[model samples]
Target: MPQIVCPACGAINRIPPGKPAETARCGKCREPLFQGRPADLDGAGLARHITRDSIPLVVDFWADWCGPCKMMAPEFVKAAQALEPLVRFAKLDTEAAPEAAAAHGIRSIPTMMVFRNGREVARQSGAMPAGQIVQWLRDAVLALGS
Candidate 1:
């Protein structure tokens, strides 16, 4: 079983393979931590979670108003569903996490950042299909030789 540290509320959640997202809960906040998709994160929390955790991270910076962003949302969710134990996926709404977006120098919506061992390894901007997203994630992991 692998663990997913919640970026939103800082709950270290142990998520076993095949575990239904409906049952996943945060130990600290006792909130519905896993929503069968990437957990949205803010600036500080996003930094903390990415640095503290050992697993690779994929972050999507998006906003509600962006049309391309909305198109990418489902693909992100699907990627999250397929890439358990290998990668951790998260989302940050630029509207809500403006500081984070600025800190990361996210000039556009649907920006994807891939981090490994607390360092950013790759970044891409624009909307992509599910297969392409998965390939990009695998490429990032392969680059790390992990």
Candidate 2:
């Protein structure tokens, strides 16, 4: 089992790999937490959480009005479902979390940033299908050796 800090309600959830979708519940809000997108994070939390978490984080920086962002949402969700045990996925709405967007220097919607040990390893901007997203994760994880 692994502990996943829920971005939805800021609850630290202990989730087993076998039942991530079932076991994932926010400790605070009791909300069903694991949604297949980047977690919206603020300045300090984003810096600390990404750096401290053991697993790789795939963050999707997006906005509600962006067409490409909407187009990639489903693909992101699918990718999160397939890669649950191995990767921690989150979605950040730039409009909602402005400070986080600014700290990350996000200039566009649909920008995906892969982080390990709080350090950015890879980033890409644009819409990618589930296959490509999975492939990118595979390569990124392999490159990180974890």
Candidate 3:
């Protein structure tokens, strides 16, 4: 069983094999497991998603004042929409959670990191188009054999 931490209530959930995750609801809060968009994360939320999600987690570390970050926002949403239920998408506002950014050694905005089993496997910086983002993650996840 794959364990997924609920983006809504932060409850760890396990979906039984053969269950369709797109229509699955959280066992605790009953919120849909995959919302087809990035879940906004603060420090604790980032930690939860990084450490608890069984699926590959793609986190965009960005801020309000960053132009590239803003440009990548919709592209990220498109990637999320296309990849959900297979990969979990999230966003961490570096402005709101400076501690988290510092902890991760984020020296620049628009840094994207992919995590699997609580460990970071790949990272990229700067903005990219939706197609590139989706392809990057697909290749990364494929390389990880996840």
- Ten-residue region with minimum lDDT total, candidate 2: 36-45
State which candidate, 1 or 2, has the greater lDDT: 1
Best candidate, lDDT: 3
- Candidate 2: residue 43 Cα off by (Å): 4.4
How many times do residue backbones clash in model 2? 7
- The reply for model 1, stretches above 4 Å from the true place, is 1-4, 12-35
- Sorted on TM-score, highest at the top, how do the candidates line up? 3, 1, 2
Better of 1 and 3 by TM-score: 3
lDDT of 3 by residue, 1-146 (tens): 99998998899999999999999999999999999999988899989988889899999999999999999999999999999988999999999999999998899989999989998888999999999999999888856676
| Residue 94 alpha-carbon offset, candidate 2, angstroms | 1.1
lDDT of 2 by residue, 12-37 (tens): 66756677454567768887666655
Per-residue C-alpha lDDT of model 1 across residues 30-111, encoded as one tens digit per residue: 7765555787778877987787666788899999999999999999999888875467788889999898899889998899
| lDDT at residue 83 of model 2 (Cα atoms) | 81
Tell me the TM-score of each prediction against the true structure. 0.80, 0.77, 0.97
Q: Note the clash tally of each candidate.
A: 0, 7, 0
Model 1 lDDT, full chain set? 0.80
